[model samples]
Target chain A: MAGYAVELRAVWKRFLGPAGETVAAVKELSLQIADGEFFALLGPSGCGKTTTLRMVAGFELPSDGEVLIQGKPMGKTPPYQRPVNTVFQNYALFPHMTIGENVAFGLQMQKVGRQEVQRRVGDALEMVRLSGLERRRPKQLSGGQQQRVALARALVNRPQVLLLDEPLGALDLKLRKEMQLELKKLQREVGITFVFVTHDQEEALTMSDRIAVMDAGVALQVGSATQIYEQPNCRFVADFIGETNFLEGSVQQLQGGQALVELPGGLSVWASMAQPVAVGNPVTVAVRPEKLTLRPLEAPLANQLQGQVVDQVYIGTDTYYSVRLASGQTIRVREQNNLAALRQGAQPGDTVCVQFVAETASVLTG
Target chain B: MSQPRQSPWLAALSGLVYFFLYAPIVVLIVFSFNVSRTNVVFEGVVNQGPCGPFYWYCELLQNRSVADAARNTLIIAVTSTAVSTLIGTLAALALQRYEFFGKKSAETALYFPMVTPEIVMGIGILVLFSALFGWVNSMLPPGLRLTLGLGTVIVSHIAFSIPFVTLVVRARLHGFDSRLEEAAMDLGAPPLTTFLRITLPLIAPGVLAGAMLAFTLSLDDFIITFFTTGPGATTLPIYVYGLLRRVVTPEVNALSTLWILVVLTVVGLSQWFQQRE
Candidate 1:
């Protein structure tokens, strides 16, 4: 197995829109997917994640630059010649073929021996936990079952890389969660590089070893799930990956890789600078909701903001408090419901202090 | 709430519509078994009990001209259907997959024959073929002159049937999920293998339906065949028309009934195939 299972070298894809305008679906983008890694391309619709995957699978040739699979440049190579298989978003199983036939299609196309094809198909189906109902047509199975068949069909070939294009986008939330875990387990067991594309941030966070957050045909940031969540690099990444409270301010001073930012209401807080910013430059500080702790008014914390609790949303596992700060900005604070006895933390209209460790906040430019 | 009952007037109106649609077919079927040779009136019922269920059918079968015409009809229908299906399916695939200049115009041209008046289309084809044969004969040797015949009729049938087949197959392609072919190709199946193993089977029902429709249209064609056919190329419909012009015989009714049966069988089989999907 190669170190980099797939590498997209400054790839660019352009499409002609319906109005005859040139639309860049993917700009000059470069990415390297390591072998046996569960990498996710996370973005909203039309962010070119699917297009990038298709180019890797040899379905679409890049308008510029090159796509290399296993360190070989793929120029004009058709999809059939590529050593990769795709699980389509719609689970495009052959409706005319039975489940077993669908799973065996790739092997049959490769002209594998009959016994080997049978054994592999059986094993693939068993891997997806669909062992008994092989003779049934694709339409006879439920959506989740059909999705599993699609996975089995592609995995039976044992391609070097598995490309999944939002394979769980159609399922309900509960089923999607189940399949997310199932897919992660399957990827680990198979030890094949899986490039998954999805718009669901939570799904990507839960299932991916690394994620590339993309927007408007550009990869905004690439990092591990925790790195992306806890340490987003830009304003868009900070906002897109999860909920975060932003405080627009100017840098007061820079010292020891940390900068003091002055907020709107004469409040000063320190934020770790991932990128160097000079003093007195405009910056945006981002802090996650869960990172902020609700404390009583007189508590002496290193970084604290006085706010009035205006709203409380009681979800099953956690309670979200909406606090109106003195700067006229509303910030959200999430508290886990850990107490056995029902004890209200802060009622609406009560004054509270929102505190956070200074180093937990990130300073972003632009 | 109580369910509303069907209005008596609406039910009667629907019944009238069905009667209007099926009355002629029912009358034709009833008269096909008439005992008398003349079917202009109920003269056979006054003297004889009724026409035999098989007498005219046997008589028509024994007639050499009718037999020849039936054979020619079958030949023309089968050959034209096969040719049209192949060409139309290829055309449909091209239309579905590719974009080129004048593609919209080509799609519109495909639908022209379907909506044009049959008489106008027949006359147009007749004129076109006459001019074509005239030019061909001018170039040929002096002794041999091209004229309209069975081959000409088959060609004309294929020309009109291609559009219908294309329309049917295109409808099927509309519902098809294109990702299935991509998946096949991704799984190491070459383009030809992907088409044959995946696309062809998935679209087989549409192709079969289109072929069956073309076959029935070619078998029962009258106006176009009448204008395009020569003496030796008389199909079953033209033969029956000629028989009607000479004398309205019970044999013509028997032939009509048999034609209806063949058409019904073909259409029913096509429906069965389509519904299986």
Candidate 2:
């Protein structure tokens, strides 16, 4: 069996800018995708996710390192020789060819027999649910159908690995949501290793088996969706993935996988530790908005702080409360709309308790 | 055209412009049917001459020099258009697709033939060919010496026509998306296969337009041909210039009418190609 479907070892890409300035587009990135795994490279624009995908597809050569497919290093291999295919962001289908011919292009390039190519193209179109569109050109299809044609065009090759660069980015919101689930099901049915690139965090969370979150040409963390969201390794990953409140403090003591921190407001709190921490070292406690609970200030609560509701917004499914602590820091709290008036009708200028346990918060030192 | 905002004044102005522009050609075509030989004025048409309704056309077919001149014009136009279109398309592809040293300079240099005055170009080519022939004759014996001929005129036509062809092709390329080539490569087509199956077919209309432009340019060229042509290589335009100095006949009107017809058909075909695209 082929080992990993795709691998990158210490890859780096440096581009010379218009003014002769060198900028590192991707830096020291090494990753491995298991066979049949749906791996995603997620980041903001200019974060090098697209560049990494291009390097894997052989559109751009790494300035320093190797890319491997099926456990074999591909050195100086042209894109047409590699055992992989790419679905470009623009869906670059040939305008001169019909949908059937577009899907059959790869097979024809490989010199497959005529009968086999015809049968395989018909089956591939059927797999994408575009059975009767064999005679229609790309311009005649709708945006969503054209997207399916791009998918079928790449999947017809049955390459060892498939690379997708924001394949659904051009669609409207409703169509993009539908395509997200369709792509996941399609990947499983084909059982091909899919390496997707996207900037949408929710898409990566919904579709990827594992994700590498990148920023500024470097991958800050790589993990499952739950691990990245609940136990991020750094503040950037925590803030980038979701809304998190940072409470600055210094470590007073270290317990079993937990740190006791003293806040600037003279409050001592406990937060889960994911990395090494020394006593008296400065650290930031990151807690998601939904993780923190808000209650009336006079309630009998342990480990709670007095805060005033600064603002309140009801967004149909949930209500967001902006609360300001006595120590001059504002934090957001989210509560489900199950409650009648959102946190029991907590309005601006009302006093409340911002309460959280150690398990809901993580300590970040760097 | 869909806006429906036409004003009669603007329409009348354009109509007047068209009348002025086409009146001379219309007069020429009408005179080709005139039976009078001198063609100073329209005497009559149809059943007046023994040669039939197309009297001047029959005279033109019988004239030997007209046939030779027509043949020479076709040979020069076809050969020069094919060569210029090929080389110019290659130059356009190279300029548009690659990053190289002096690329800016090369792109700017293609406009030299386009912006330079055609009369200046004609004189320069004459002096250059004369110098070249002088050097070749000085080295060789008298029987084998090179001189200006059909080959020299053809070379000059190709030189002037390339810039127009390249500019036309380059304008078409400005709107092309390069990612299609990458997608072809990703689909396992090699570079040559991708170019043959994808690039050439997509850019075909632009190449045809450039070829038509080159052909029309080569057909009517007179100044360059006048200086560079040798014995027995006179094209229709140069031959007509010689006839102008000697006599003004209705056959010249017939030739001009035929010239206008060929240009109109070529232009019609080019428009058809663009609309099909």
Candidate 3:
């Protein structure tokens, strides 16, 4: 816990194609993670998340920078010399060996004493809840079971860093969710630095302590889940993280730190921050569907607009309404269902007023 | 639409094709016991001119020279097949695993010997050994002649069998998952240990199949061995050729039947092992 578990400094990797053409897989990326932290690289496909993980695992070497483990630079260090292990996407379990043998493979390679290897392998399997499956080959297990065996194999080595490259991508939804919690528990018990890579936003949000969301080989933001969801820095993260309602308008007037936005047809709305926009600068206002509150047509409130409900959908625990404003812009509003109280329902042609607080919305520049 | 009754035309055509392939072997086996020496005859049923217990067959078996030749042939076939499979499988793994310059050229070179004419290869080897060492006849025993002996025959069989083994092993390697080896390496195993413990076991069935093929090919080989063997190193095929020319004896037919039996046994075992995997 005293030293950084892993450090990657200005790493750049380029792959040469068959015809002498170079394709940059990763640009200069520098990052550090303390001991026992669960850091995740979240991004879409071809965004260099997997490439970055491979470089740390020593499967691929960076063309321009140095990688370090425990305060020592890794120059041409083979995978066996590095104190790190990787769980590949497809599990990569040895089909010819039994589960116990696969787990003991690393210990046997180090020529550890026989009894010690067996005890550690058993403990690793038990941690993953795969006890008593020692003699079964990988082909006999289900996809999820195979993935657990792979995890056990990598963990048996007691490496300083565990690199997971989309380990749960091959599993179905239910199994993936179950393993997500299991992995979190295992990480806590082992207390090692875990660097995981995935393209699923929800998965990252649920398990990671810190996330680095990347796009096209560049990391756009790194923060806690709440920060990433509530205050995305750009249009990509805002659209990728969750659902948002966007309103295009220009800043009609700015005072102090707040600005009044004028929508088309002279409808004015107050925005909380004018840091990203000046007077007469165009911007898009983003508000969550749950943030907008609906009321009767006669209610009077600041930032109030009258609109007709065009459609309504009743989910199990909530009701959603599509409201059309006077200028023909449709806005979505969600209301929680209260089973104990009875109220009048909004119809397709009913006029309604919707209001959003000034602090509940933010403006997007691009 | 209702399916038509079994097509008589299709059945007849396929039956004719089967007959076209097997008719010669059937004719040869049937005439092996013929009594008349006119080289062709229908002996019909019993009392066929006092057949004398097919004495030509017993005489052939009693000859010590024939027994020695059969022993030599079996030794060469088994040994060469084993060695060639080892080399071929290693070559196949190298070709399939790594990316390097001249890979395509290396693959083509491995297959080149398989397609070359046997006579040309035999003559080339004979010339090279004689010109390089000058020991073809001047310094060798009679049984160790370059054109006829156990050593030359084994060498020739191994040369031709390697390409077939490589081709079969390469096909199996194509479907293999190399990540299994990577996993082993990550687990702290060295490169060679990973290959032996994980990769080889997964592809053992393919190696067995390739060895069977090499054995069968070596057992039946004639042209190459005829050019490279010594007098004492003559194999079953060369011996049968001599009998077929000198006397046109029924003993040759009996020998041919034995060869067919050995070939079929190897083929059956190969198929069984392949299906088991």
Candidate 4:
């Protein structure tokens, strides 16, 4: 990665209320994005991600600390002087201007030569695959088209960092998926750092090289997608990133990286690691559904736990089973639709045994 | 398709309202060419009496005082509209897009001029300028009496029109997204340039609509203009008022007809502009 394109050091922002009360929107946020890196601020709404982005954009000023762009302190430097462009969630295209005019707006402001402005505008539009839509007003375009126009307008200036605040949020499900791929490709082609903000976990995982999962103005974890998904640092990150079946228990045994946990009904299970917990300390064991294996009622397997099949669902690619374990706890297991149509005729009352490797699940200490 | 039809009483009530509103306008247009000066009775002969339609219409057009009044009215309307629209549009943009102390109170203050009675506003402005400034008697030439003539009338019109302009433009600005300005700014346009190149063009239609409304308000204004205006600044409405009390003439009907036509033209143009949005 190149030198940091944008950097924030312990930035804080406070909003004053009508009654002179102060509310901190962004609390001591410190982050850095290298050149050409796509970083995502992933969080639920009002988690200070947008505030952080706004602070970087100079739409807001930090109450404390510093914002740096290309190694310069950007204190009170207006957005126009900042070497960054923002793709707003609503795709805020100039309603009065045509697509071409909107793209040429920045160039015109800098007093760029008219010929150069037109040429650059054409090139930018072509980059976004909107070459022929020059004369169309923003309202005349579809939502996706307007988004592209917005992208082209920002990208025309070739900003060092592109800040996108849920740019694909206004799109429908299928369109959002398509735009995600398009954005990734655009980011690569442009080779500029992208600071994207989103509440959607899947979007962050799909698009970001590094994800900062935030909650309540605090960043819980910042890591690669695999690190975030497989080895979440906290309970919030574990629950937020993906679905995890949590089994609360005290650590019965802790040897090296593996641990055995005793269940409530005299059952014991082995897990990969007991997240730095001492023996008899409370912990929640998290396991992915696909990690477990299901066998016939009497089939022998390592770490056997007997259960009855409460529900079976065929999802074309995989068949899912909701098994009621011996301890009255229900756990889900997904099986790939292999050659054998296993458990097709298994009724809700039929008994089954669930098995999985010790390393497939991890024990999260609380 | 399954809903019951509207009652006849409701339809009759609506028709009565339509008649009540337009019947006077119809009477004015018809009596503009009334053979007799008094519209209550029409002589059998048309254009044969001393109060002929052609003669009165000619008199109304040829009268220098009426012409001067029309010119003054147009001048005041256009000037005040221009001034107020500029100020009001900027105010709207500032109040809508920024966060500052007492913004809510500032907005309320903008609308305060609109709520205050025109007579009250006029009298208050006059008293403030004359008493507070003291330049009223000491600075100005004789016979001025601190009355600003055309200037005072335009200023009063602008004062009344500003609130309306701010109101209309503010409504448009409220629905406007601030992200566009951010986008422009992000792309390297300075704040003022962004406002000029992006914000102003987008909000221009609203400003225009408000200005047109202001012009109409200024043109039809009588009480405030009458209170503020000196002898030389007799606008059309004041002239019409004077004619109503002074003498019987068909020229008022001609002048009234012209005024209605101009109003209709402005209203139609404004509607056309508003619909483009």
List the DockQ of the predictions in order: 0.85, 0.88, 0.69, 0.75
What stretches of model 1 exceed 4 Å from their correct place? A1-3, A299-301, A337-344, B1-17, B43-53
Docking class of 4: medium
> What is the per-residue lDDT of model 3 for residues B168-194, given as tens digits with 9 covering 90 to 100?
888888889877777777777777888
Per-prediction TM-score, please?
Answer: 0.95, 0.96, 0.86, 0.90
Residue lDDT tens for model 2, A1-366:
767898899999999999999999999998989999999999999999999998888899999989999999988899999999999898999999999999999999999999999999999999889999999999999999999999999999999899999999999999999999999999999999999999999999999999999998898899999999999999989999989999999999998999988888888788999779999899999999998878877754545778899999989888899999989999999977785644377889999988898998999986
**Model 4, which residues run further than 4 Å from truth?**
A16-22, A296-304, A340-347, B1-13, B35-40, B44-54, B94-148
**Ranking by lDDT, best first?**
2, 1, 4, 3
Docking class of 3: medium
For each candidate in turn, the interface RMSD (Å) is: 0.7, 0.5, 1.0, 1.3
**lDDT by candidate, in order shown:** 0.91, 0.91, 0.82, 0.84
* TM-score of predicted structure 2: 0.96
Q: Sorted on DockQ, highest at the top, how do the candidates line up? A: 2, 1, 4, 3
**Candidate 2, chain A: TM-score against the reference:** 0.96
lDDT of 2: 0.91
Candidate 4: tens digits of C-alpha lDDT, residues B1-277: 7889999999999999999999988877777776777767645334744556565677787899999999999999999999999998888878877888999899899898787877898788777655744764777677765656898888878888988998888877777777777787887877688778878887777888888899899999988888788888999999989888977566787788889999988877777766667
Q: Candidate 2, residue A194: CA error in Å? A: 0.2
In CAPRI terms, model 2 is classed as: high
Which candidate wins on TM-score?
2
Q: Estimate, for each residue in A140-186, the C-alpha lDDT of model 4 and write its tens digit.
A: 89899998988998888888888999999999999899999999999
